[model samples]
Target: MASEGSTPQQLSDDFTDLQKKLQVVIEARQRLDAQLSENQAVQKEFAELDDDANIYKLIGPTLIKQDKDEAVMNVDKRLDFIDKEIKRIEAQIAEYSENSEKKKAEIMRLQMEQQQQQQQQQQGPA
Candidate 1:
């Protein structure tokens, strides 16, 4: 629904707008991926620790002691949330990509038609 315009200029504008949106979605997906990786690393570290091992979290430049089980649970929740966000963004990216492709094809078709019209005009009375 984002790229319904049919005019050459309108189609070009829609394509540009979709590209910008795609870039933003990609950036967001990248950030979510980084967070997911970090959370997974933390989970791995937790797995390697003893049940009685001390766990600390940095809070505003201060080391705050946190229960290992609670920390693991929090990290698990964060990973799940990040995964969902990534999936949502990926869907948006796919939609935007499809729409952009359509707009590009329309623009090319319009250009070719214009060229054909010009050729016909030049050959007038011949």
Candidate 2:
């Protein structure tokens, strides 16, 4: 047979664990957002450099123009990789948020059940 108060303790533990998981997910999302912002700044700078390099190609000497063209190509490749990484992180954040919300609802339901059980027990024979 089940004990009288064990259910409440179990529900409390489950709620705590759910809260901790949500906190971790929120921190991870913040870190990803910060990384995305930094990558965007770098991408913008790379774009500006690419534009300047293209302009130099039209008027500068042959060797200088070739070097600038190569640099722009490398920056373009790096920007493409960053874009892919940002998309992956965004997808992960969406998944984590969804899971966290579900867990929160479960915890709430468990707590309510525990409360109802306690009330029913209190109303029974002493």
Candidate 3:
């Protein structure tokens, strides 16, 4: 039966899928890092500004005057959201990395088994 012998193709496919998922998570984390850096810079700039400093927000090509406190609050909110997202993405990366390692081990085991089987058959009656 086909079940008597495991196919490497299936294991390869699973490993590839795991790799792709891991890559996607890594890319997402990179984007989040960039966003976090940018938001932190904005927050720092806001901290250094005078309370009465003019704050303008770009809204559909128009600069709308915004309160300094409000701008600071908005940046804080963005930083919080980004921090949460980074944590979530980090968890995903760990999971994917673990799965990928398992899949690779499984593939190696299957290859070893297949090699042993071929050797036995080639040796004929022993």
Candidate 4:
């Protein structure tokens, strides 16, 4: 079943097409894996933040009724540091989300481009 009309260029194009498709799949999988790792890191950070909040709660009641000014001052200093830490964590979370969105968009664009190339190849003369 030999087709005498088939050109070597067509066969080469087909091999290139398969290679591009495989590359796209590999890149997409890598992106997904990176996203998952980022998500886990975010989750771990949130857990640590929750632990800090619990510490604040545990100390709040004891510090409220204390008459020692020096002790109160120390507690206030610690609380200020905690507040700053919370703000920093919020900023980090926001940055992570923004970066994640950008990565997702990039991956989507690449996938669409790959699909369009495959379609064009299918429509081209054999």
* lDDT of all predictions: 0.89, 0.61, 0.91, 0.51
Ranking by lDDT: 3, 1, 2, 4
Error of 4 at 61 (Å): 22
Worst 10 residues of 1 by lDDT: 1-10
- Model 4: lDDT to the true structure: 0.51
- lDDT of candidate 3? 0.91
**lDDT, residue 2, model 4:** 12
In TM-score terms, candidate 4 sits at 0.45
lDDT string, candidate 2, 9-37, tens digits: 56456556656765776676677567667
True-structure RMSD, every candidate = 1.9, 8.1, 2.9, 16.0
Model 1 ranges off by over 4 Å: 1-5
- Candidate 4, residue 112: Cα displacement in angstroms equals 0.5
The residue-level lDDT of candidate 4 at 98 comes to 55
Give me the runs in candidate 3 sitting further than 4 Å from their true place.
1-6
lDDT of 1 by residue, 10-81 (tens): 777888999999999999999998898889999999999999999999999999999989999999999989
Relative to the unseen true structure, what is the C-alpha lDDT of residue 50 in candidate 2, on a scale of 0 to 100? 45
Task: Estimate, for each residue in 18-115, the C-alpha lDDT of model 3 and write its tens digit.
Answer: 89999999999999999999999999999999999999999998999999999999999999999999999999999999988988888888889889
Instruction: Give candidate 4 regions above 4 Å deviation.
Output: 1-67
| TM-score list, all predictions | 0.92, 0.55, 0.93, 0.45
2 or 3, greater by TM-score: 3
- Angstrom error of the Cα, residue 117, model 4: value is 0.6
Error of 4 at 68 (Å): 1.9
